[model samples]
Target: MNMHNTSSPVTSKPEELVPSRYALKIGDIDVMVVSDGVLPLPTAMLAHNVDPSARAAWLKEMFLPPDAFDWALNAVVVRSGSQTILVDAGLGFDPDLHLPRAGQLIKRLEAAGIDLSSVTDVVLTHMHMDHVGGLLVDGVKERLRKDLRIHVAAAEVKFWDAPDFSHVSMPPGFPDALRSAAKRFVKEYGSQLRQFDEEHEVAPGVVVRRTGGHTPGHSVVRVASGGDRLMFAGDAVFAVGFEHPEWYNGFEHDPEEAARVRVQLFKELVETKGLLVATHLPFPSVGRVAADGDAFRWVPVFWDY
Candidate 1:
């Protein structure tokens, strides 16, 4: 994670000018890390139980500003044999949101030479706006490949389809938006929408495991071929999640439960020596976890240029 130098002064860029696509081969599967763009997350909102001084020091050490954190929106595309699986749909084609930094995933995929129509499966890790927004590209309903199948957790679909208004506090119109999106997705996908309970094999080598907490049915997608393994941990943990598994994000459906799940996932990664591909981590968010005392640490794998 500390791949960059801390002595350099970070500059605010109007747009991401670098290439937002990366690819790697895991045995027979081709995994591509695609970036939608970067969003500014307020630091105070995710501080949780971390000490102010310690948080500030960690930000400075990571060469980041203390005020706003750069949260990346990443989606994974796994090509195993004849199956092309897309892990998540990023912030889809939206121009009025004013968040010009995001919503570039569709273009990035095209640049990567990926044919959207060839996508056999679209597996949503969760229905977060950033994650599911890309279900439609350019406002076309059928933009999602003609021969595509969608996989989602039964709990997740049920939770969003009939969200409990009680004990729920969200920005104005957000609840309605969630419900509308969930309904529309179900209706549009129709028989193509497949929901499962705990674990499901979306494809031959890609499996989705339910690890709730961030959302009612949040899950992780594991891609395995031969002996190589990689986990697309969709928001199970973020950049500092490994180091501070107890620090819960304010947006979590259950803060305490999210922390517990984070710890569990970290332990499993450490034991299995698996590669973690986080959605909110920095671009090309591929790394490994290690146990450090009672907590854990993130060690990003070196990428060959």
Candidate 2:
């Protein structure tokens, strides 16, 4: 499909003081990490399965607040050959939740010169509100091309039909919001969905594979070209995941399986030396992985000016 933008009016809002988008290349593919803003959530959400004291100790060691903190929300854009693929849509506005900082994907994308209509394909990591809500934003669908292909795991769609939340540990009202978002997403975009079984290539050198831990059909996108590699590892890995892969995030649907997936992905990154980017990591979260004894280490790349 030929991706082109329909002109939209430039608003009078002032430009942001700090940069919100980081661009890089994996050999031939063009990649841009865009900030959707931040989500101020409880620190306990990081590792609810572990003891509070242990979680507190880690927070202290990291110099973070013990009660709550902002989790960086990020999304990525990839251009390869003739296709422009959005890795995940950021959290759009949710009135019920008081997260005012998040849901900046659409504005950030426009700031980065990416139009909704220009996106040929959208590869969702899962049906989580944060990963697919941007498309649900006001008038977003109207601006998008009618033929826009949304590739999500078939397992994810089926699971949402009758999602299981007994294994999760989210705050009150979150589960309902998540379920509503997923249902609304499928209802609105059902016809455009291109459900994949395991893995599918969204564009040249861009492949998304189901990982199934955070959600039943959670997936990660891998971009490989020439000798370089990078993985947009949805929710499989987090900032704390490097040191304590076993600790379960409150958002995980299956904590045990999520931990296993995290460890496995870390090993793969270490062996292949591919760059890593995740949704909940700090903004512009592009880094590499290293083995720190039995645990893992995050080695962020030095920013290129």
Candidate 3:
């Protein structure tokens, strides 16, 4: 047998090896989770307040690398009646960070047959670069509809005005990068912002609600229709959060409050039995929460092929 199949057919176009988008329905509404790609970060970003050995043990339990790992970055697109809402844009190109794997949202959206012009509104969960940088990508704004309404917590925009980095524990250069991204985003698209005080319905069943924690204006989007429900939790919850609800993510501006919000959201999920899709959770992050002793358990929904 030949060592190499030199005669194999070659195609002009190559497709991705794995699926990047997963679509599901919540009653009458349609939701699709699109992966922007992954960000490799120090494991210490997971919980700054915990002991190194404890964190290492958790990593061991999960069979993950103890030092650093790739964090999944997800963005959601929701369709309700006549409105198309984009939630939490993924990390858009940051050359200085040398994170070339991330910031693939725009192209991924195109691959998924989602057009920027079709988006009528944008519901931002927070002002973090990973959550809003996609909008700042070159040519993105020009492609968006002129009347596009970007819904966000008024508090979020205000917080970025004079952001407080004293509490966060991110890796070096993160704070400055985040600050620059937020400032540039505001300067570029300030006119389109639709700042809301507490909660606002983007469409018939899609409501964005503020639950300040990770950031002063960090929020979550709740989608409900008929009898089905789902929530797109921004950074309030992480993969480690379900088991270690008290652990503080390095990105959280107020770690204590973020922990509280995570537990509270878990209780709410347990009570309502709503599907959970968070920004930092594994790809296609659809799941339900169950009370497991004093902690919580992540019950991922079966893939609906």
Candidate 4:
């Protein structure tokens, strides 16, 4: 959910830079994570943390700079008949996250022709800049509809809404913009909030489940249609290339615990043939987890509808 940050915001507008990315369609449901744009991850630094040979191969094949790394930020959108849900809202002009190709979530949303007022529900897995960035429009609370069923995990609600959550709030830890949105959510729109826990149905085929480790209250949603299922795994894995099941992002507050959940969930995903939709594993983020060698490989499928 957390993208590496700089103290200052990027001057380049997201729409002016990276063209929004998309990959859509699955069964009776049409799913896509419209891109907010890409973020520059330090390649040399990230590679140093990864397997050198794998890093080298990706540097050549994946078009990554030998010295720097860049990753696309894609927040998910699910459409089942008239029920449209955005899983994670993208980066919303936060000066703190200091991202190039930033603040493109709404444009991507508009490209999909989904009206802000018509969004029936917004399932938030956890509150992170890239994940919840589009929740509040740039500098305006009224821009985001309060009538939408803003689904949040019970554990997440307790933490972000808790008085102690202020340290992580904006202003203190470079999240000044989000702090305002978070405060507005806790106060005026509290009635629109409908709390959920692990393994509960939010919509007809949409269900939320706990996959803690990334964040204390972090969860994933399973959208089932015509016997097929697609899972929205928010920040469970970053970087499009797959690696050891124990692989994790450095920003995960709890790497060990996240790894455990990943290992277990991956096993289930392999068995179910469920679509593994990672927020950061390239745009559209649609893939299938397969047993490659001793670990797993993320097979990014070319999806269209």
Clashes of each: 0, 0, 0, 5
Instruction: Give the per-residue Cα lDDT of candidate 4 at 271.
Output: 93
- CA RMSD of all predictions: 6.0, 3.2, 6.0, 7.4
Question: Which residue pairs in candidate 1 have backbone atoms (N, alpha carbon, C) closer than 3 angstroms, thus clashing?
Answer: none
Q: How far out, in Å, is residue 18 in model 2? A: 2.3
Tens digits of per-residue lDDT for model 2, 1-305: 21123223665874776668888889888898889999998898999988999999999999999999999999999989888999899899999998888999999888778878898999999999999999999999999999999999999999999999999888888999999999999999999999999999888899999999999899999999999999999999989999999999999999999999999999999999999999988878999999999999999999875
Worst 10 residues of 2 by lDDT: 1-10
> What is the TM-score of candidate 3?
0.95
Error of 2 at 297 (Å): 0.4
Q: Please report, as a residue range, the 10-residue window in candidate 3 with the lowest summed lDDT.
A: 1-10
Task: Write the residue-wise lDDT of candidate 1 on 139-235 in tens digits.
Answer: 5455556667888898888787666544333444556666666676676666877889999998888899899888889999998888888999998
lDDT of 2 at 300: 93
Model 1 residue-pair collision total: 0
Query: Which pairs of residues clash in candidate 2, taking residues 3 or more apart in a chain or in different chains?
Result: none
Once fitted onto the true fold, the runs of candidate 1 whose alpha carbons sit more than 4 angstroms away are 1-16, 49-54, 94-96, 164-180
For all predicted structures, in order, the TM-scores are 0.87, 0.95, 0.95, 0.79
| lDDT ranking, best first | 2, 3, 1, 4
